[model samples]
Target chain A: DVKVTQSSRYLVKRTGEKVFLECVQDMDHENMFWYRQDPGLGLRLIYFSYDVKMKEKGDIPEGYSVSREKKERFSLILESASTNQTSMYLCASSLTGTSGYNEQFFGPGTRLTVL
Target chain B: AQSVAQPEDQVNVAEGNPLTVKCTYSVSGNPYLFWYVQYPNRGLQFLLKYITGDNLVKGSYGFEAEFNKSQTSFHLKKPSALVSDSALYFCAVRDTGTGGFKTIFGAGTRLFVKA
Candidate 1:
């Protein structure tokens, strides 16, 4: 079975602190994504990488950046954590996007609380 | 611009009763629709998707969704509900733009299954 693992399941950070959330997938998928899930906002895409070293901003990418140094790992960095940024973060990976295939498999999410 | 809309904010159903979660989508061409379920603090799990087929697509954990071309809707349903089935359900659509692959999610619907 394809497995997407996240570095932390729960995290607490202070305001103005830098935060790093890591995601790894064993399926060798070429596409990796980072999203923040909130109550009424759903899962808003923060950043995505189609290939190693390639990244693109999603709808709500402010104050967030992504790093995809390897094929299997994608990291999301919060430059300065704030109380408003506290939410559940999810990481997903999908097989190389094709004309017809784009099924994303997600990892266990990390719930971050900024104090 | 591609977007997803989950009509219901919450749905409550008794165990052994049928349940439905409604979703609608907007896109330029034929749309790729997806359903995911998030439990507690876990990541969203892929439930089902509708690319192109018989409209009625069966997926994991006895869940199925029917795609209506005319109405541009992909509504998820299950014959029976279990307490374990209670979770936050999300509907997503692929944004087929030039930049890269991105999935747009809707404001999730919380499903409460009562025993």
Candidate 2:
């Protein structure tokens, strides 16, 4: 079965601390995405990587950065955690194609709480 | 650019009854639409997707969605609702014509299945 694994299911960080959320997919998909989900606002994309070392900013990329050093691993970085940054982070991966296109497979998610 | 909208913020249904969650989308050309379900504290799960051909798409957990090109709507439905079926349902869209496959998700609709 295709699996997307997140490094943390729950995380707690103090304001101003650096935070790292990691995601790895076993599917070897070329496209990986990071999103933060909040009530009512839904899931807002933070960053995405289409290939190794290639990243693109999403709709809501403020205060967040991403790294894709490896093809299977995508990382979301919070340079300095803030109280408002507390939310559920989701990671997803999809293949690279044009015939039928690819659908995203999401990880279990990481709920981050910054106090 | 592609955009999705889930007009209803919440939908309430009694257990064992059929339920429908509405979703509409706008894109320049043909659209690749998707439906996902999110349980509390869990990440989004792929329910189903509509690429082409058949308008009705069946997915996991007895869920299905119908794609209507005339109305530009994709509504998710189930024959019967279980307590486990209650979740936050999201509708997403991505343009397959030109731009990269960057999915845009709707605001999401919370479904409550009551006994």
Candidate 3:
């Protein structure tokens, strides 16, 4: 079975603080993604990495950055956390082949609270 | 742009009763549809997907979804509802014709099964 793990399940940070959320997948997938889930907003993509050191912005990538120094690890960084940034962060990974029909495997998610 | 829509915000069902979660999508061309279920405090789990071929695709935990090309819908269904099945459900879509590999998710529906 494929397993995806996040560094933190829940986190609290003050305004203007830098926050880092980590995700790791054991399936050796080539594509990794970061998304913020909010009520009525669904899962909006923040950033995605197709390969090491490669990143692309998604629908809502403001105030967020990503790092993919290695294949197994993907990190989401908040330049300066704000109350509006509080959300459930999700990480997913998928294989590159099959004409992009691959199903993404997700991590447990990190619920971040910014005060 | 690819997008997915989950019309219902919540669905309530009694245990042992059949349950259905509605999902509709719009894309440029042929679509890859997906259904995911999220337990409390857990990540979204892949329930099923429809790429091509069979219109009805079966997935984990007795869940299935039907792909309707004419309607542009992929509705998730289960024969029996369990109290344990109560969770948040999301529908996703990816445009196969578009060269982009990004997938869009719906706002999500909360499912409640009463015993």
Per-residue lDDT of model 2, residues B20-98, tens digit only: 9999999887778999998987778889998888999999999999999999999999999999998999999885543
Residue pairs whose backbone atoms clash in candidate 2: none
* lDDT score at residue A59, model 2, on the 0-100 scale: 83
Report the error of model 3 at residue A57, Å. Answer: 0.3
Model 1: per-residue lDDT, tens digit, A61-91?
A: 9999999999999999999999999999999
Q: Whole-model lDDT for model 3 versus the true structure?
A: 0.91
Query: Across residues B20-104, which tens digit of lDDT does each residue of candidate 3 receive?
Result: 9999998886788889999988899999988889999999999999999899899999999999999999999874543545789
Residues A18-84 of candidate 3 have per-residue lDDT tens digits of 9999999998899999999999888999898888999988889999999999999999999999999
List DockQ for all candidates: 0.75, 0.72, 0.78
**Candidate 3 chain B weakest ten by summed lDDT:** B94-103
In model 3, which regions exceed 4 Å deviation? B95-100
Task: Give me the iRMSD of candidate 1, please.
Answer: 1.6
What's each prediction's clash count?
0, 0, 0
The candidate, 1 or 3, that scores higher on DockQ is 3
> Which residue pairs collide in model 3, if any?
none
Question: How high is the TM-score of chain A in model 3?
Answer: 0.97
Could you say which candidate leads in DockQ? 3
Tens digits of per-residue lDDT, candidate 1, B11-113, equal 9999999999999999988788899998886778899888887999999999999999899899999999999999999998888774437888899999999
